[model samples]
Target: MSRKVIVTCALTGAGDTTSRSEHVPVSPAQIAADAIAAARAGASVVHIHVRDIATGQGSRDVALYREVVRQVKESDVDPVINLTAGMGGDLFIDPSNPTVHLPGTDLVSGLERLAHVEELRPEICTIDCGSLNFGEGSQLYISTPDMLREGAARIRELGVKPEMEIFDTGNLWFANVMVEEGLIAPPPLYQLCMGIPYGAPADPGLLKVMVNMLPQGAEWTSFGIGRNQLPWVEHSVRLGGHVRVGLEDNLYLSKGVKATNAQLTERAISIVESMGHTVATPDEAREILKLDKVASA
Candidate 1:
């Protein structure tokens, strides 16, 4: 076990989970409150993804992001806010037509995608390196090389730390290429997303392979969705990487047990401590991620 680890709470994901858990924050106020609660429960960072209130679906709207960021910052909780720039890249292609997009496809330009990050200027923002066949079938989260480079360049220009999100080995390769091209800043931040079907599995062996592929001295945190959440928390920290947890990834504390964001974060903290590792506080995480102490927004 490492001496110290940082726990991040992914408050509410863009997933279809509003109906699954009563604790999943739908409104901006609820999202912010859940984030603050996660911080109070021992998370040093809160990874956020805002949703449309009426529909309770994922969105890439700048106004939604602004509201969420504002509320989290204004709250007494000082957990490092990490916004998701992963939206606006969905490509549910028309299989029959092969050229046209399906109903759910929501592809936008790299500039449009990063507009929220540019506006909010959070401590950290995610830049998905490449696209992949998401889920079991019929959906694809498309992020081309040109688009990835453009997103990375924009994040670098805005002076916001880009948390390079790697879903598979190719994404990692593209990230390394970005590091070489100077699109990504030095000592980069990474989030190894595992076990989302068609991408890397949540297996410990696969996690190790991905961790080994990271550039030397890179700071990374890893998380798996659903059942893999808690197990990967221990897997990440044991491999000298940090951990992320919360309702966005998994809804249960145990069998049929609905968990709030704070409950998940608290559980991750316990795992970290049980391994003889200390979970980083907000201040410690700030220094570790090289984040600005104050938000520019």
Candidate 2:
């Protein structure tokens, strides 16, 4: 059966990719502009992560998030805004002294992480379901059961859909527990994040297992980082799921070729169309995800 895929553009992740690619947006205006461009290029949703304007690193500043959301809402194209509530969970431990928190650590309460989400009230926000080793460094992403519960409850209360981000099988398992515990409502939305270090490897077998583990009738999408970004688009579509692409997962359109968010969205659209599948509009995506219509500003 043919399907209409919802293409989500994850603009500028919190990673340190600014130096690697000039296309990564750092300021709120740049991020909003890129999101609008991606929307015009056929993206139904825009996953956002604000950066420190001065340092070009990730930030949890509520004002920065406010400005980005404001600009996106004021734009002509109305893609579903998905803000990242995954910040404030980084736990950088001191290598020599494990008990000593390092400089990169930015741990905070779950409520503090959702401050922007509460104030902005975007249609969608992400909740990283569980903790992981994160990456090659001594850094660890901390999302305990209590933290997930608090985040999920608050997101539910705000009437915003929680896009559960599953980094590994354990995260997926706890996400199911969140649903069973009645924190998340029906028609859950999930983003199967593959190819990250120390988590689920970006493999077809792993994707198949993760996809099967999703709640019945759930709306899901999958992505792979770096070289696997484009390939995973085809994999997701073939596996009866949606697709995500942007500078967040990859910096290059091809080897030695930098790519903008709009360029990535266009590429994803081309792939979907080539497979005899239509790309869903923002309104169509809202319908498919069962999200209430967000009024235009």
Candidate 3:
């Protein structure tokens, strides 16, 4: 049995989740408030993704990221702030032109994606390990080996812990390669993203297979989308891993009953405690993740 399980709340994802649930935080104020509440409710880490409030579309503007980080730090929230470096990797191809990227393709260099982590120095940030065919369309989430190497190196130099985001088995293998290449810090962190259509399925058998591939001495968490989110709270624990929950990956406590990010965290904490496991606080979580000591941000 796992002694201590850390809960990470993914506040607001960059997907089209804003309209799916009115409870999803849009403005920076709302996002910060939700994060603080989730921390108070027992989440030790908060993964964040900013949006254009007017249009609810994902954005990579540093100004928006700066405000979000500032608000979270200024507030009483002590959860580890994890900004998304996975933004700028979305590649919507143009079949018409074949060679040219479409309007939706938000292709940016690895350095450009880490601007927020470099400037704000969040305790943790995601370094998406590999690219894959996303959903049923022509959309592809491209994170090539070269980009992953550069992103991991930049994050390492900034003294930020990179939570290697692995969408599939291949991604996990490549993360190990980065570790060997001296691109990442020691004892690399991983987040096993399950059930995103084109990626690995949200099955216990598959999750175990992915978990088995984790490098020795790696810290990891696994999460499944939609209905699988709640089940993963227990699955990850039993598999010697941590847990993550929030509106970013799921919205309802029950169908037709929307849930706030704090509610989701509370529920996950309850499950952890029920299983004879204790949850870690932000400070404690930092130590477990081997993150830099909190600065006076």
Q: TM-score: which candidate is best? A: 2
Alpha-carbon runs more than 4 Å astray in model 3: 293-297
Clashing pairs in 1: none
How do the predictions measure up, each by TM-score? 0.96, 0.97, 0.96
From the highest lDDT down, the ranking of the candidates is 2, 3, 1
Instruction: Give the candidate number with the greatest lDDT.
Output: 2
lDDT of 1 by residue, 1-297 (tens): 257698999988888899988999988888889988998898999999989989999988888888878887888888888899989988887778778888878889877888888877887888888889898657888889998888888787787888999999899988999998888776788899998878888889988988898888889999999988998888898899999998888999998999999899889999999999899999898778766622321
Native-to-model Cα distance after best TM-score fit, residue 87 in candidate 2, in Å: 0.5
Q: What order do you get sorting by TM-score, best first?
A: 2, 3, 1
Candidate 3 lands at a TM-score of: 0.96
Pairs that collide, model 2? none
On residues 189-238, what C-alpha lDDT tens digit does candidate 3 reach at each position? 89999998798999899999988887789899999898889889999999
Which digits, one per residue and each the tens of the lDDT, describe model 2 over residues 148-255? Answer: 998899888888899999999999999999988988866888999999998899998899999999888898999999999998999999999999999999998998
Model 2, residue 112: C-alpha shift (Å): 0.8
Scored by lDDT, model 3 comes in at: 0.87
